[model samples]
Target: MPPAQNTAGPGREVLTSDDIDRALRRIAHEILEANKGPEHLVLLGIPTRGAHLARRLADALERVEGTEVPVGSLDVTMYRDDLRSQPTRAVEPTVVPPGGVDDKVVVLVDDVLYSGRTVRAALDALSDLGRPRAVRLAVLVDRGHRELPVRADYVGKNLPTSTAERVMVRLAEHDGEGTEGVRIAGPAEVAP
Candidate 1:
């Protein structure tokens, strides 16, 4: 398929809607397999798109396991280290599922994984809530450019590119209908 235009100028569609659906389904199965039946498992999305993805993953998990999974949103705004340097962002609501995070296997979900700072902030934010038996990271895209020591345990797509480029994920759940795909914008080459 031809590359689609992104708002940030010339870009290419990395993952179509079908591709995203397949990837999420696969990630759902992987999550179930890794956690072994979803018992005591909690998925916390990092607001915006991640929250939507979490809900989708929970739905997929329910389809396979025939059991409901607890999913919620975790906002890491105040915990972000770059708050001083970047533009100020309003703090989003952090919702934890019933039973809390204590003793549960918590999975932090995000739309893209670039610099590890966000995950690090998430860890800090999560700690303030409650202690979990374990914490894991899941991302729809892992665009390599690590500024901190962080890695996603579950990734949908690994698109390596220079820091100059941007990975834009537009989900219908967040960006409205007909805008569902992952795109790379700016001048950068995707590593093989």
Candidate 2:
């Protein structure tokens, strides 16, 4: 593929514009191909960054295949197993529209897939919503170190990293539309 033209805007970026654009393009193709070109596709993105990525994916898919896909955001903090045990209380209020997930192909999108806990919580959240015909996972970055057996159906980038590295997905939606894009770095840089 030819080099991507990112055209990063104003804000500071965690990753370069070209890198994120390339990843999204690749992921868009993967998603369309995986599901037979975006028929009956519903993208449910985990809260925060995942929601941002999902929106980007939706736009990318629309541009790539001329399909307007439904996209929504989900908050799984309450569904998470470790929320109560953690030092800080997590945010909640998982929202799924009344559209009904029954008999539809639901694709869970996230910024980064790491320990798999988020995906686990997401699965739980989906259960409360409705039973879909099929459920698949799509992640922008899969930094290996999974404590659970979860895996992504479509991965944009499989960045092999040790336990100490943190994959940060900085999108314009969250970080104010900027020139820089999503990035992965050391844990020391992460506030958590």
* Best lDDT among the predictions, by candidate number: 1
Instruction: Candidate 1: list runs displaced more than 4 Å.
Output: 1-10, 187-192
Score each candidate by Cα lDDT. Answer: 0.90, 0.80
Tens digits of per-residue lDDT, candidate 1, 1-192, equal: 988554432378899999999999999999999998889999999988899999998898899999999999999989998898875687889999999999999999999999898899999999999999999998999999899989899999999988888788989988878888988977554433
On the 0 to 100 scale, the lDDT of residue 60 in model 1 is 88
Using all chains and alpha carbons, the TM-scores for the candidates as numbered come to 0.92, 0.84
The superposed Cα distance between candidate 1 and the true structure at residue 117, in angstroms, equals 0.5
Query: Could you report the Cα RMSD, in angstroms, for every candidate shown?
Result: 4.0, 5.9
Clashing pairs in 1: none
TM-score of 1: 0.92
> Over the stretch 48-167, how does candidate 2's per-residue lDDT look in tens digits?
888878888889999998878888887888888997688475574655645767888888999889999999999998988888999999998888898899999988778887787666
